[model samples]
Target: MKTKAVRLYGKSDLRLEEFELPEITDDEMLAKVVSDSLCMSSYKAALQGGDHKRVPDNVAENPVIIGHEFCGEVVKAGKNVAHLAKPGDKFTVQPAMFYKGSLEAPGYSYPFYGGDATYIIIPSEAFETDCFLKYDGEAFYHGSLAEPMSCIAGGAHVNYHTKFGSYVHEMGIKEGGKMALLAGVGPMGLGTIDYALHASRKPALLVVTDIDPVRLARAEALFTIEEAKKQGVELHYVNTAEKDEAYVMELSGGTGYDDVYVMAPVKPVVEMGDNILGMDGCLNFFAGPTNTEFKAEFNFYDVHYAATHVCSNSGGNTQDMREVLKMMGEGRLEPSVMITHVGGLNCVPEVTLKLHDIPGGKKLIYTQIDMPLTAIDDFAELGKTDAMFAELAKIVERSNGLWSAEAERYLLKNAKPIG
Candidate 1:
């Protein structure tokens, strides 16, 4: 099969090209990628190229495709995996296939098994590690979003607290305890809020803080206080630009929070999370810093006396991905809240290379289409000239400015096909 993909040849060298895919072995499968969500990790991989741990050292000579968070349909299932999947089966992958402790993963390490292509050969390691998951959701974008949402789910799951006497560690965030998300208005932070509000285990009082009023306002509008109240969660959106740590403490009733999630890699944000932890509190540093020397201060005094601790996670395991997919399929979680931009496969090179400069949430790409990276917020303005944007504007406006299954269907049906 022939595939169009964005490949990384070296540091800051990403190219969009078409190439023939080798025939799938009996241990492998064939898939047609439909939707992929751009991640900051992909940008980092492009920046470091072969230097990135997951990227191969010979990447300059053997370029690898550059995307991991993706979803698609099975075009052909090899005999060995036929029992697990079949033709036309919708699927998403857990790209972190830590097969035998190797750093190699799908997007950064594999030439024929990344998300940025129209077609790919599923490697045998994915099946061996049970990372090849079947997604039954109606929208391909939801399947694409499952991987990211699982990271949030994994973050929550990995948090642990200890009792005063026993040596046992209690896993997960403290249920019915106070929780805070610092600098939490970005895409991953938004997903964290969604999971916190709707997941089986939840905090009684949920506080989200951000420096940007525009982002905080948008977050409030999307995950309304009214909706949180129905779920028995007291939700608060605090603009830290005007308020101080004292103001945040007032909301927690003078006592510190039981769970504090640091959403940004900023030093101040990490220190703020550390300063507000109650006894036996678990602080989850959810952001992944690009710098190897990234450091933040924590009160060791509290750690020694109050039993406070810290933990971090880069991506979710297979079980976390399954939970996210289950929640999405049950209509309990709306991962679409993370998406801010949409484009086609043709735009993947530029978008992936300069992703950090482009401000917004997730940038979703449809592999078979040919369109520039366009913001959903700009749909109405673009609608004045294009009839397709006009209809999309109406569809999203009715859904309160969020992307939807309806919009994906419309775009795939109307947008120009990738040539």
Candidate 2:
């Protein structure tokens, strides 16, 4: 079969190309690429086209694929495959296969297959040990978010600060405890909320916060806060715009949110560290900042004095994928619930190019056309490099301002400080 995939040839360059299928090696299973999730990293690949380690050229010297989230049935299994693979056995793939001899993490990700195209060759590690669960659902998006979910799972294990002591926690969540889905409005952010809500047994107060009035409104409508509360998940939408620090403090009644996830873009988090997160809050930096140049400072004294610990993770590992899939199977983690917009391969470049300063949850991509995904159009391309960049800069600035306004408001509404 022919497959279309993305390759990072050089810095700031990503191109889609078609390829012929290769023979599957022993101890591997072939899977069709069904649903791939878009991440900030894809944007990085679009701009910095080359892999500094794998491909020395700024442009891709050879073809490489960019999708990681996906699931499918076994199309073909290699002769020496140890895991019993039969056709029509639907399964969810755990994107990365960390093996002894093959890991290129520091400079670039090792050849971990992704779920963005016609097919893929997976090592036995993901399935031999039962990491990739069987997917029986008719629709595809359910299991495709394994990598992202795994990251969240890992984040849960992070060591953040708390009022009493270190914010360290185990996946051994209590039956009925007070937990909050802090900054739980964006698409990825929403996924975290859905996971926490459904994954819990007795349920907790499912409070949500977002700076955007529109997104908060959308989330409320999508999943009635009250309805979830009936299932033991209380929903509270906090607009960081109105209440300020007092509002969050009031919500806790006295103590702070048990679990605070930093899901919004970067700045809100710096603001969160300074404003909310009571004496003993577990802050999960759910969304990793994209631009390194962008910096926001928080208090060192609050961290040391309050005994609050902060934790962050890049992506999910294998254990998380299994947990997310099991939750999906039983109807806990519903990724389909967070999808706001959907488009085919041809739409990726435009989606990425747009200054997403507008309020929304998540935008999903199903395909990538064969060619470079260019965000800028031809008219802007022909102009002088500096001038065109300046114009593009304008679009980004306008969007950023709108985003900031909404975010500041969100923090105030949900993140409360302790006495």
Candidate 3:
């Protein structure tokens, strides 16, 4: 089979090319990628190339396809894995398959198994590790989003707290306790808020802070306080640009927060999260810093006296991905809020290389189409000259300006096919 994909040749060297895919062995299956959500980690991999731990050292000679968070349909199921995956089965993969303790993963390490392609061969290691997940969700984008959402879920699950004089640590955020998300108006932060409100372990008070008022407004509009109140959560969105930590502490009744999450890699954001910890407060440094020497100051006095602690997770495990899929299927989690831009396979190389400079949540790509990267908010403006964008603008407008399964279907049916 022939596949079109964006491959990384070296540092910042990405090319979208069409190549013949080797026939899958009996131990492998083939899939047609439908939707892939671009991630910051992919940008890091492109920048570091072979230097990235998950990226192989021979990328300059043997380039690997880019993109990890993807969902697709099975085109052909090999005999060995036919029972597990049949032709036409919709699926998503947990790309962090720590197969046999190797850091090699699908998007970063595999030449024929990444998400930024029209077709891919699923290797045996994916099924062996049980990372090949069958998705029953209606939208392929939902399945693609399950990977990132799982990371948020895993972050919440990894937080730990202690009881007085007890050596044992309790997993998960403090239930019915005050929780704060610092610099939390980004895409991942939005997912974190969605999971926190819908997950079984609910926080009594949730405060999300960001320096950007525009982002804060958008977040508030997406996740309204009235809706949070129905879920028994006292939710507040604050622009930290104008207010300081004292103002946030006041919202928590001056007792400080029980669970504080720092969503930005900025040093002050980390310090802010540390300063507002209550007794047994667990600070989750959720952001992944590019710099190896990234450091932040924390109150050692609080660590010694207040029992404040810290934890973090890079990506979610298979189980966490399963939980996200379950939640998405049950209509309990809406991860579409994380997406702001949409494009096609032709745009993958440019978008993936310049992802850092792009101002948006998630950039979703349909691997079979040929369209330029465009923002959802710009649909109405672009609709003036294009009939497709006009119809899309109307569809998303009916869905409250968010991308929907309807939009996905419309785009796939009407957009130009990839060359």
Candidate 4:
């Protein structure tokens, strides 16, 4: 089968090219990718190329497709798994296939098995690891976001210890506990907010901190204070650049935070999160830095005296993805809140190259269409010049400016690549 994709060859080398997909064995499956989301990790991988830990040594010879967060429809099923794979079945995958103690994740390590392509073969290991999942969400983008959301879910579900020798452990964020997302309202932090708001173990107070006013405003627009009040969640969006640590501490009524997530990789931010932890507070370092020698200041005093422990999770497992899908299906979680822009397959290469510089949340890509990576807010402006964009603007407006499945369908049906 012929497919188009953005492949990674080496550092600063990403190419959008057409190639013939190798035939899958009886133990494999092929899927037509519908939606893939750009991530900061992909940007790192693009820059690191062959040096990336997950990237294979043969990437120079056999370039790898360059996305991990995506969803697709099953187009072909191998004889070994024909019964489980219906031709038109929609699904998302947990890309972190920890096969036989190996750290080889798809979208970085596997050839012909990543998510950037229009079609990809689900390798035998993926099936054996049960990475593929049935998706019943409203939009394909929801399926695409399942991976990142699953990572947040995994962090939320990490068990905590009060003492080293203690046999008992605490599960999730404490029920009705105070939580703070330091350097929050970024793409992944938004998913954590969604989960914190709607998960069964709800937070009584959620303080979202960010230095950027634009990001804080966007986050407030998505999750309004009024809605938080309705749900009985005392929410505060603070611009930390302007506010002092004392002001932030007062937001939680002086008890400090029960849970603090260091969402940024900056050293000061990480250290700041460390100092704000309450007794038995669990600080989760959520952002994974690309540099191997990346170090941050930590307060060992908190660990010894205050019983505050630190934890970090790289990615979620298959069970985490399943929980995220279940939450989405139940209408309790809206992972699509992570998306701020949409584009077609052709947008992949450009978006991958400029992912970090892009000023917005996650960028959603439709693998079948050929359109520019246009921000949802820009549809109104583009509509003034082009008739097709005008139609898309109406679709977006109908959904209150959020990128919806209906809008996506309209864009795919009418929009064309910018000439």
TM-score (all chains, Cα) for each model: 0.98, 0.74, 0.99, 0.96
Q: List the residue pairs that clash in candidate 4.
A: none
Those runs of model 1 whose alpha carbons end farther than 4 Å from true positions after fitting are: none
Question: Is candidate 1 or 4 superior in TM-score?
Answer: 1
Better of 1 and 2 by TM-score: 1
Worst 10 residues of 2 by lDDT: 401-410
Indicate the worst ten consecutive residues by lDDT in candidate 4. 410-419
Q: Please, what are the lDDT tens digits per residue for candidate 1 over residues 1-419?
A: 89999999999999999999999999999999999999999999999988899999999999999899999999998899899998999999999889999978888999999999999999999999999999988999999999999999999999998989999999999999999999999999999999999999999999999999999998999899999999999999999999999999899998899999998889999999999999998999998788889998999999999999999999999999999999987889999899999999999999988898998899999999999999999999999999999999999998889999999999999999998
Which residue pairs come into collision in candidate 3? none
Writing each residue's lDDT as its tens digit, candidate 3 over 316-344 gives 99999989888988889998899999999
- In candidate 4, stretches whose alpha carbon ends up further than 4 angstroms from where it belongs are 159-165, 417-419
Q: Model 3 scores what on Cα lDDT?
A: 0.94
Residue 344: error of model 1 in Å?
0.6
Instruction: Between candidates 2 and 3, name the one with more favorable lDDT.
Output: 3
In candidate 3, where is summed lDDT lowest over 10 consecutive residues?
284-293
The lDDT of each candidate is 0.94, 0.56, 0.94, 0.85
Model 4 lDDT, residue 155, Cα: 90
How many steric overlaps are in each model, in order?
0, 36, 0, 0
Candidate 2 residue lDDT tens string, 294-397: 66666668576764546677666677777777776676666654544444454454454352542344445544322222222221353356553344435334
**Candidate 2 error regions (>4 Å):** 51-59, 101-112, 123-133, 157-177, 201-203, 349-359, 367-419
